[model samples]
Target: MQPTILAALAFLVFGVTVGSVKIVNQGNEALVERLGRYNRKLRPGLNLIVPLMENVVLEESLKERVLDTEPQEAITQDSLAVLVDAVIYWRILELERTFYAVEDIETALKNLVLTALRSQIGMMKLEETYASRGQINQALLQQLDGATATWGVKVTRVEVQQITPSRAMLESLEAQRAAENKRKADVSEAEGTVESIQRIAKALKEQPNSQTVLQYLLAQRYVEANLSLGQSANSKVIFMNPKDLTEGIADFIGGDEPNGGGDGEGPKPT
Candidate 1:
């Protein structure tokens, strides 16, 4: 009977020793609550706690984590709708505040990020939103860092992933871009034509039989223009008399008051 009681006592002591030992893995932390109240935190490695009275209420990794938010619909200042998404890199600086200050850190962070993203986008035009992604990311980081400081979470980096316009908006933008390109091309072509005419007029003024040469060149240009219109499927062909066109071109190219003439007097017949 005496030997059995000693064995039972030894077994009880072994059980208590095993129960008191707590091994915390690296990069992890645990919060201990004594008798259902806050007590202390356990860092990596072995720790001890009163088995029945103390409890590990929380255990979390201290390493940095990534949170990716889904694309959210946002309206630009121009009333255009776009889908925006982002990625947030963060880590806990004070586990206690992180646990107590916010009900769910990740959820709160996501909502905060999205709210800031929308607000920033709301103040910008559609074109500006696409061009100012860096500005947006910086603004978001600042805003988040300030806001989450109380929660004991450090926002390390923020990245704006995608900003996409809706299908209808994309099509409209493409059409606008094409129209702008066409307008630029037309202006360039018009300038080239004017320059060519100026050069030809200057050259003709220096040559004998200038009037005949100008008339021939004007007729040739008119014929080529007509041929181009005839070849185009969408051209609205306008048939103009060649004589009138030539006369107009000659008057424009050579129209200048005769030397020593009054303003009321026109050019003398060449």
Candidate 2:
């Protein structure tokens, strides 16, 4: 063969060889089509195809990916508008179906999620929506997985990141929570007071010096009741005569003592 002819043939052979090989990276896939018809899938690593006959129509990742959905306003069963944002975990399962069956996978997956979310939220009240995040996530996962099955996508997980009520609704919820807490506190305080009264009554019935103890307890409570009055920076204290206090104490205990010197008639004026 002539040297120039040999060089031209060698170059053509090199071009043909180069065009026949396809290398797909790890965690990736490619779809091949032959003359406008589905041929086969090109998996990860080196693949061979007929030069000028087969074409790689699409390349897609096989690894799991996250899809963050934009916040969407959805109405609850109670007619409250809630803004919801979510994340979807998914990946392509079949490259051929992914490329041919779904026109736009991301857009489709997101829209499907939004629709399913709205539908689920619509069936529940605002409180239920807030409280049922796990249920909502599971519901979304199930719906998305089922719907995307035909599109060659596998939805592994779904998460509801945020569910925000409107300003007025939020304020109402806060008020409701506060009122509930207050009611609980009041009930607890009332229970404690009742328990204290019962214990005191039992002690009085069982003890021989109950009357004297009761009188002392009453006096102590009276002092404590007025203790807050003396906490102010400008608080004033009035001195009462000890003689009058002694008389009052006797009167309060219904005693005229000397041996019962103080008359038990009534309290003496301070």
Candidate 3:
């Protein structure tokens, strides 16, 4: 009877010993407390604790965690309401502080992130908000890192997911941009016209014989004009060489004596 009683006590002790031993997974940490007071943190793998004396409160994951936040409404400096969404990457650095320093790290992190976003958006204009997303993200990460440091949480990065303005505001902005582009296009067209006119004038000034070319061009214009006028039925077409027309006009005006035809010998009768 004594031997059986001793065997039972030994079996109970063995069971208690096995229960006291805890194994932590890789990329994780275990926080142990003695008599409800702060105690040592256990690294990954096998760890032994005193049964009924030391209690393991929580196991913290050291691997990075991704937290995607819901969309939040933020008012810009221009008083325009914009919807902003973001995501944060974080991980716990200190096991003890992660479990004991904060009751709920995720909730606290989300609130902190939202407040930081609001503060950032409030200081920036609508255009700046869109243009400075990178700056905003960096600022948010920095702020979150600072705030969560005490809670043993490290913020790796913060990303802006979406930023949207109201439909009316977007339409107004589009109209404004369109009007500005139209004004620029008109100014460019007018400048191009002026440049073309200046180039033509410069070319004409450089070549004095351009007047003869102009006369040929005028003859072509007359032919085209006559063809167009014939469609009116009340118009008449006249055909004459440009040299003969010039000479006839000179004679009618009693200007110079007529030159000999094709020989350059002496003056001849008209």
**Over 4 Å off in model 1, which ranges?**
171-270
Candidate scoring better on TM-score of 2 and 3? 2
Question: Which candidate achieves the best TM-score against the true structure?
Answer: 1
TM-score of each: 0.64, 0.62, 0.62
Kindly list the per-residue Cα lDDT of model 3 for residues 112-206, writing each as its tens digit.
Answer: 99999989999999889989999999999989988998998899999988889867678888999999999999999999999976665455435
**Candidate 2: segments with Cα more than 4 A from true spot:** 167-270
Better of 2 and 3 by lDDT: 2
Collision pairs in model 2:
256-260, 257-260, 257-261, 257-262, 258-261
- Among all windows of 10 consecutive residues in model 2, the one with the lowest summed lDDT is 252-261
Model 1 agreement with the true structure over 1-270: per-residue lDDT tens digits: 999999999999999899888889999999999998889999999999998899998999999999999999999999998999999999999998999899999999999999999999999998899899999999999999999999999999999999999778889889999999999999999999999878897987676666688779878988899988899888898798987776666666565622212354755899
| Candidate 2 lDDT tens digits, 129-207 | 8789999999999988889999998999999999998677788889999999999999999999999987876776466
lDDT of 2 at 147: 96
Model 1 gets an lDDT of 0.89
Find the 10 residues in a row with the least total lDDT in model 1. 255-264
